[model samples]
Target: MNSFDSSIETYLSNLHFGHLATRSIASIADLYTFKGLVLIPVLWWMWFQHDERREWRREMVFATLFSGLAALVVGRLLTHWLPFRVRPVYNAELHLQFAGSDLNDALLSNWSSFPSDHAMLWMAVATGIFLVSRRIGVLAILYTALFICLPRAYLGFHYPTDLLVGAAVGIVIAYVMTRDAIRVRYATPALRWIERHPAPSGMLAFVLCLELVTQFDELRTLASSVVRNL
Candidate 1:
């Protein structure tokens, strides 16, 4: 396993190009990891505008949110329990090739790179969406592989195995969350509560959007601090 990881990282790190095109591709890929948030508004519109698909739309939204949240919780727990693993960029033994200034020294200071949180969340969302609509699910899975996971690996943020394990965990979480027993036991009650309380739900959604768009760095810093202090 170690040999396989090192070989792949070596091959990829050797292929780095210091060009504007490569930088652009890496930047676009970084953005697309968080692009699942874009579905919120689109699903919102579909829920109201397309009455016939309202049930499906609602399920889709619920699945996405639930899966993403579950992935984060599970991924973080695993990271905390597992031994620390340095990212390729920070590992002294590895040759890391970064294309642009987007990846800075401070970003590479952490040693929590065993399982990628980004891959876990995005893959979970993709799998959840797949359970809702096959076409969108297939697209989401492709996006996760091509745009989200590959770019991170290309940039030396994670080893390929980190993504594979994280993605597997995500898929499992999505499947568990979509189970009929789990849905009836948890999701139904939660959805009913949200439906009964619009103001709080809207406020929560606003806060989530704000955090995702503007305060993600701060949130990540806080989360890291909590994990370290634990």
Candidate 2:
């Protein structure tokens, strides 16, 4: 597995396009991967589709968000609980040729890379979409693999296996979570509130999506500060 990972990374490292162009593309991909603004609009498009099962659509959207959170929590727990594995870029053994010159080495120095949270979260959301609309779901999954996961591997942030595990786990969790019983239990009440109180629900939903786009960075930062103070 290590050999397979190394060979793939080695090949990817060698294909690091020219200087500025590669960096720019990677930067954009990185931004979209976490911000997920690109995918969110697509999800919203799915939400408002003129289908009879609008409630089911909304329920699946809620399941997407809820399952994404589940995937993230599981990813983080595994990241911390399992033995640490350094990112490919930091693994001197791989001799990875970084595609870009700029990286916040310090920020991720302590972070493990055995399982990618981005892959887990994004794939979970994509899986949820797929559950709702098979055609769109296929597109969503493909977009995630190409537009999101590929860049991370090319940039040396993750091994292919890391992404595979993360995505597999996310897909499974989302499939189960989006099951009729599970989604109904969690999303029905929220859907009812949205139906009854459109104004408040709109505002709250916007805030929630904003936070998801930003990966809840502000909230996590505040939590970290409180933890440090304690």
Candidate 3:
């Protein structure tokens, strides 16, 4: 496993691209990846698009939302349950050089980087999107792997295997969640309830989206502060 992680780590670190260009990218990624400005909009478009299968797409939206939340919770639990591992950037042996201006390390000193929660959440959502529309789903997945997952590795927050494992788990969870039995049994009722209570539901949805877009940073920071006070 060390050899596998090191092989890709060595290559990415060796890319002598000017640190300036790399910093620009890291800054852009840090700013936008968590913002979800692009990705969430795309999902909304998918959900509202006029189609012969509008109901199916609506169901899929719920599946996407539920699966992503589940993956995020699972990732957090695993992070706590498993042994702590240092992020690649923090691992001295890697000798990784990165533009730190954009990387958020305020709460990462002790955060385990074993399986990337971003990979898990985005991939699970992407997988659910794929179920609704193959073409869009494929694009979403590609966007996720390239724009989202790749940067985690490049910026030294994670390793190749960390992403792979998270993605694999996310994919599996999404597939299972989207299965006919689960969707019919759960998503339908939720959708009906959402329809019946638009105001409160919309408010809750907005909060959930906000948290996801920010990668729960605000919540985590608040919790950390509260713990310190306690």
The number of the candidate with the highest TM-score is 3
Candidate 3 regions exceeding 4 Å error are 33-35, 98-104
Cα lDDT for residue 90, candidate 1: 73
TM-scores for every candidate against the unseen true structure: 0.83, 0.91, 0.92
lDDT of 2 by residue, 115-168 (tens): 988889889988988888899889889988987888888888889999999999
As for candidate 3, its clashing pairs are none
| lDDT per residue as tens, model 1, 1-230 | 39888888888877756687677666755563355554444434443555776655665567666777778778778888999888887776665555533564575566488798777887887787777778877987897788778887877788899999999998888888887777666667767777899899778866764453332557878888999899
Q: Give the per-residue lDDT digits (tens) of candidate 3, residues 56-76.
A: 788888888888889999999
**Ten-residue segment with the worst summed lDDT in candidate 3?**
98-107
Question: Candidate 3 versus the native: TM-score?
Answer: 0.92
Instruction: For candidate 1, give the lDDT.
Output: 0.72
Angstrom error at residue 70, model 1: 1.6
Q: How many backbone clashes does candidate 3 have?
A: 0
Q: Cα deviation in Å at residue 52, candidate 3?
A: 3.3
